[model samples]
Target chain A: MTALYQQSLEGLTRLRGIAGAMVVSADDGLVVAESLMEGIPGDAVAALAASLMRRMGTAVSAAGFTPPSFMHLQAARGALLVVPAGPDILLIAIGDRHINLGLARIEMLQAVEQLG
Target chain B: MRALEPWVEQPLMTFLTESEARLTLLMTSAGQVVAQHGFTRAVDIMSAAALGAAILSSTEEMARVLGVRPFRALSHQGESHGIFLSAFETPRGRWIGLVVYGQDTSLGLVRLFFDRMVDELMAGVPAEGGPKQVLAQNFESELHSSLRALFGR
Candidate 1:
């Protein structure tokens, strides 16, 4: 892994309640880099997250809003956070429901900046 | 979409809707068409099936030459469109799926749904005789018949 990718994933994975962090292709949903816990199903997560991001972008644009830079999906058991790293890449983090969204959001934005 | 086999229609329809594929063809390893969607001409479907089969055959051979297992799927992305090809096993026989998608969908989404479609197809397979064996002498006739059935020509 490149130093930037490793650093970005490591920083996110170090956060409390974070189950995994991945750099994913926004267009294809392929995993570029990841720091995942056991049994996280990284491939599925990456694909679903990218799909959701695409849908969100389309819906938001159709509504006359700019593309979203950040997205948070909170489910009953977990939450998924996504930040666009670039036009074709995304920074994604999966965590438990108890995760600190404020800290995670800030760190992810910083990581994305560094990645850029 | 039109299917040569009745059981394939539902699964293929589901895949077409979910994957947002602009064009799709389901065929056998021998290049016989089973179903197709978004193709306006019979000639185009015939060309795509033949090409897809040949490409898959060559790639499978390449994998053997390299001492690797045969690849399950392949994809190519162009500026305005993309193609995805994959083969899966069914109770009847091996089948291939060729999909063409545009900017409205991604390869990841197509593949994810393709896998699900494969599973559904397997589950929906009729518990009876296997596929009819196509003799080499009858291959040309079969191809023409399938095309006529699909296009009503």
Candidate 2:
């Protein structure tokens, strides 16, 4: 289980513009395992990503749409992509603005299925 | 205070009206609001700005530890509405965008125009002048005030 998490995370970072990746708890925002480069702060990502996920859940459920399968945040600097790796775990990816989002989405979905 | 303000206001208002978003806010990376549309209350703006800034700062730290560059945008999709947040740099300074939209618009639509908005904001809008990259004085103190405003403390 640990190896799977580590391997997938390490693999995510190899993608073009992908800087780091990690698996975190959606409920508690704790880091399970991470493949982070020198400057990326995985701990804070894990915590805040989880918190944001919780908040998004509230807004989503209140509105009556399908519970979000995942979430993405876009900015001028780069992109922060999160998807469910498991029932309670979130896969977080940080990439450059130039990163191919289409491919990143495919990679994340595949990783989730494989993890499942 | 910033010459860039006039240029962005019109475009942002247009985006909000055309896109039918509940709210769209533009702010300094330090969480200062430059312009906003579709908000009924000032407190809501203050809350959104603080949260947006907090999330961006934390995510930037996440990027630093990941040894990657930075994550520019973020989003959360609810049932009836969705939130899209992104950070970008301009000649004026680094800024962040926080958007809230309902079923009247989809995330993809907001995104499509948002990218265009950036292009519009940067290239189309001419900067009259204002000591490029100028930012609010005492950002930390201002952030504290925003938090106080948010909590009514």
Candidate 3:
């Protein structure tokens, strides 16, 4: 893998209670790199997530609300936390239903800062 | 009205009211107060209703062009977390807003509230056909076209 891919994997590895993580391009809804969940359809998840991200961003923008640099969604079945690595890149983590979302968000934020 | 029936369900309404959280629902298009339970005062419901309307109006526009459905967005402020906006489409093309708020609460409860509320909302509506067909036929193209113009997209 490329250095950027390895770096993202390393960062994702550090987060607690995350079931899987991926670096994705919200611009095209493609997965650039991922860690864990070897057999899962990581690409499809990335695409759907990126689409959701873009839709959410557009929605908030049109509402005259401040556009978010990150978006988080937690459901009864699972939780999804997305952090913007840049305008083009997003770091996404899916967690077990029991994971701590706040902690995961902070960890992802730290990773983003480090990725800079 | 079947559309308004679930709000009055005895156990379900009571569950919402007794939970250690704030809850409210609104009609997206008209921003009308649909149902509210728990500790939410009038101001809170009003604000959430407005927030929901704005978000739904914004997303409905995007969903039209993309042919994609919109989901809920959750925001957190300190220890108080609020999931203030989301869309649930009735079989007749009417959209309802479902919202819930909690303090130091579990993610489980929040999801439960959201699912239950949306399910209730959908249940009250006559399900003569499925959601996919209804959404496909009832695409809010006008909303999308207007938004694209507004946002220069």
- Candidate 1 chain B: worst 10 consecutive residues by lDDT? B134-143
- Report the lDDT of model 3 for residue A98: 78
For residue A34, model 1's alpha carbon misses the true position, in angstroms, by 2.6
- Name the runs in model 1 displaced over 4 angstroms: A1-3, A59-66, B131-139
Which residue runs of candidate 3 sit more than 4 Å off their true CA positions?
A: B1-153
Give the per-residue Cα lDDT of candidate 3 at A63. 96
| True-vs-predicted CA distance for residue A66, candidate 1, Å | 5.0
**Per-residue alpha-carbon lDDT of candidate 2 for residues B29-63, written as tens digits (9 for 90 to 100):** 76656777776666777788878887888999999
Q: What shift in Å separates residue B7 of candidate 1 from its native position after superposition?
A: 1.9
RMSD (Å) per prediction: 2.4, 11.7, 13.9
Top candidate, metric DockQ:
1
lDDT for each residue of candidate 2 in A37-89, tens digit (9 for 90 to 100)? 88887666676566667678779999998777778888899888889877878
Most accurate candidate by TM-score: 1
Ten consecutive residues with minimal summed lDDT in candidate 2 chain A? A43-52
TM-score of chain A of 1: 0.97
Q: How accurate is candidate 3 locally (lDDT)?
A: 0.59
Report the C-alpha lDDT of model 1 over B1-153, residue by residue, as the tens digit: 999889999999999998899999998665568899999989898888878877888999999999999999999999999999999888777788999999888888888889989999999989996766746555466667789888887
